[model samples]
Target: MTPPANAPTFLAQHGWEGAEIQPLAGDASFRRYFRVLSEGRRAVLMDAPPPHEDPRPFVAVAEWLAQAGLSAPRILARDLERGLLLLDDLGDSRLRETLDIAPEREIELYEIAVDLLVHLHRQPPMSGLRPHGLDQWLDEVSLFPDWYCPAVGLDVDGAGFRDAWTAVLRPVANDGRAPVTVLRDFHAENIMLVDGRAGVEHFGLLDFQDAVAGHAAYDLASVLEDARRDVTPSVERAMLKRYKEAAGEGERFEAAYWALAAQRNTRILGVFTRLWKRDNKPHYTNFQPRMWGLLERNLAHPALGPVRDWFDRHLSAEHRAAAWAQAA
Candidate 1:
């Protein structure tokens, strides 16, 4: 992996002086991060060049999480103008990579994750971390038809899919009470198991630049219906119930769970497609089948009448069969 032209000077100007920079391999995005070793200490240098990415969101959200007592990679120094930052190296182990340790230990580690999410949701709504405006959501969600359909070569029944998405999402995005903090990508891969003061626990929250105020269910849906791992049905149910008990009952809260799951899963469909077509990342293609199952799960709720009907008509077995062939 080649370092971008300016990375050496950029890292050196910051506290990474005399540090040896080496690429950290294996990620889907164009962003490149490095392991900086110096004086028996280590840090990470995140290099995000423009057009491909903007580091402002990560900067903003990391500060927010830090204020909330969550462990974010501490910014040792930065040159935001050049898109470089030396951060505390949380370590090399991620929760996904450590799952083989012990089944009971894995479950315990994930429980801490559930708690972090609950704490974030309890905070008052805030906007700087995520794209929160209704117009923004509509504009972003609307792009699904444009990007996803063509990417996989689906002769998308565009009007059909759009209508279902609108029917499923409009209510929550329009409501005042539906608002809550959301860590848009709360999942295993972004978490690292660390040695906590009390005991061994997961630390090092990463890729949370998209945290924002949204429907309470948004992050929960991200956790339960993850993109990277197939968490079992029993685990999913247990987590959902724990959250429900923690958040307590209200008709609107329950309704938001179904509505938010539908909205998030729909967005995942568009995102997964874009990853393959625009980003040229094929690994995400492996998850399309499960993504469809999530879509269907959302539809099964009676509140999603229009979504259910749309899936029955559009993304049925016949539709996927053709789409898979096109993808191949």
Candidate 2:
């Protein structure tokens, strides 16, 4: 994780003449992160190189989330043309790892996260953002048939797959509740526990450049039905109840939560496959079984009948998680 060629110049311009750069982490995307230490100060350097990645939307959304009183990282400096950004260090205490080390805090930490969503959904959706409504939902889930089916050597009914998702999601789209800002990738890994901040401010947000003006239930579902981690069913149920009660939502929200959770899991199945096959990231295959588990649970919901039936007709038990287990 070498720093980009112009990183030293960028740091020098930002008044950090001799910073120590250490690799932080990379995600499923082309974006890379590094920790910068100079004197006694620390910051994060985001390398979102041109053509493959852009840093502007991240800047805009970070500002929007901050203005909304959420804990998105503060952008210290940026060079959009070269796709470099210096951001406040949110530290290494990720929500996922925190839970891993102390399972007893699951409910407490999750309740705070749920409370953050309740607060975030109260605000109006940010202006000038793309909508992640029915159309986007359908488009995204297509990746399952587009990539996953082919990878498993199982021919699926692509048209039927779309029809099933549409049948399930159309009602969710028209469920009368207005759209809120959907932090499209609001999972445990993308969250950090800031040391000094208290309450919801303690949880810093990340990987939200794809934030959309979409269903309020979407982010809630994303956090609970995570692909990389096993959120016990009891915890998921508790958190769902927690969010619904806090937000004053009822049956319709429940329906949309399961429907969108299935939609998201289905899309991720294909996304991880695409990452492995096309993007040369085979390690993503390890998450497929977990995705399958979440999707299976989601399909059991009454609203997802069409999608469930479609899966039964096309994808079999052997073709699902079992296949991925072998691949992994």
Candidate 3:
């Protein structure tokens, strides 16, 4: 494969002249990653181009996670002006891949992830982060009408959708409880299970530049209600119980969990659809049915009354089935 245009110059400038660079798997963003080998030393390079992506947030969040004693990749060298970062190579054993090979280890891996979240929530909020509040939630869900709905040949009242969601989320947003550091994309794909590290340090975090001050339950929902894979009901129940006991937030936490799960699932439906329709990455549509199942399960909770009612009235089961079929 041809090397990136800037890789040679960037590596040379960093004293990694003639290093071997191999492409690593990329996610749903414009950023690309490469594994660099120089003098038997391995590190990862992130290429985030300007006018499309920025690396500042990733750098800042990495520092914060390290200060909090977590396992974020260590930055070795960076050129933010050109959006290149040389980072510690955290290995290739993603938790999802490990679970795929050893299905029985699902419970163990998920437990470790939950424990990490419990530790994170226990820490005081990180300063200078934006809140993932009502507006952000609505902005995400609006994609349903703007992109997903159209892709499926259905018309939705976008304004009405926002108004209804506002009513559903206002109580939680105005509860006066301070927000926690929410790693917005905490899931199997972004979490690595490193060898030889004890406890939470064994879990390597990724794609957390989108971190924000949000309800603790939001990340909990992201993990248990994962869009990429099936999480058994038994595992979900156990993890929730463990988190409740560890965090000591009780019923309020439970309520918020379901609410955020509902919101996250709703937004994901739109996001996956947008990925297929706008980004030309059609594979995301394969997860729509799983996402829809998770959304329905979360909407079952009484705390999601308004949002559930809106779905029932506007997007019926028949419509959902038709939309899924069309998108798939």
Candidate 4:
């Protein structure tokens, strides 16, 4: 994937003339990133081509998060018509890679992440974002039956799947906790460990364009029960306790956490499979077992009885993680 045709013109117009452009990364979406080295300055160029991609939401959320005192990337320049953006480079030290290299920093780093959520929840959610509640949850989990089941040779009951999810998630949607800004993709891989920044600022947020006004526990569950990496049971427990204590949440939060974790993991199971089958990104299959592990743990919660029972009857262990073992 080369940079957009007019990326140089876009960069030059923004004073990044003749900068060295190097491919950085492309995420699950159509967006591609490039590192720009101009003179002594460094920046990241976002190529979010039109029709299939848009930069407006990203710009809106990034600006909103910055205004709310979070470390979202600064938008230096943008050409929304062409779906291009030049942003302050948040650097290369991702929390996921950092943890892989230094597992010892797990507790310390995760605490800071939890604290950032604690602080974020204290603020009013950004206005005009989509609501993520029972309806959204039901729709998201539908991906499992719609994609995953068919991919693995199971013709599971779609109605039963939706009903089971509705039973478990309806309460969560009405849990009465105030909504917070949910960085929908909050996870280790999307976090940057910035240098010279202390406290929560050390964690530069990314991939948050799809943020919505949603349950506070949603993002907590997202980070603690990460889909891409293993978070030790003890560490997960510690962080859950830390968030509950800091956020003044109790039993309801715990229940919501598990329920939402299962919802997220289930959705990701289908999503990763879709990425493989429909999108031709076969590498995502490698995360299926990990997703199954996380989902099974979430299903173990007593409150998720209906959802768990649905899975138990429909998907056997061999059809669950074992089905993906070879792919992993």
Leading candidate by lDDT: 2
* Candidate 4 local lDDT, residue 22: 93
* Candidate 3 local lDDT, 66-105, one digit each (tens): 9998999999899899888999889999878888899899
Q: Which pairs, if any, clash in model 2?
A: none
Candidate 1 lDDT at 77 equals 82
How close is every model to the real structure, measured as TM-score? 0.88, 0.98, 0.96, 0.98
Alpha-carbon error at 49 in model 4, in Å? 0.7
lDDT of each: 0.70, 0.92, 0.86, 0.91
The sequence of per-residue lDDT tens digits that candidate 2 reaches over residues 116-145 is: 999999999899989888999999999999
Supply the global lDDT for candidate 1.
0.70
Better of 1 and 3 by TM-score: 3
Worst 10 residues of 2 by lDDT: 319-328
lDDT tens digits, residue span 1-328, model 4: 6877899999999898899899999978999999999889999999999899989999999999888888999999989999999999999999999999999999999999999999899999999999999999999999999988888789988998899999999999988888899998999999999998988898999999899999998999999988878998999999999999998889989999999999999999999888988898878888887898898899999999999999989988778964365455
Any runs in candidate 3 off by more than 4 Å, and if so which?
none
How far is 278's C-alpha from truth in model 2 (Å)? Answer: 0.4
- What lDDT is reached at residue 326 by model 1? 58
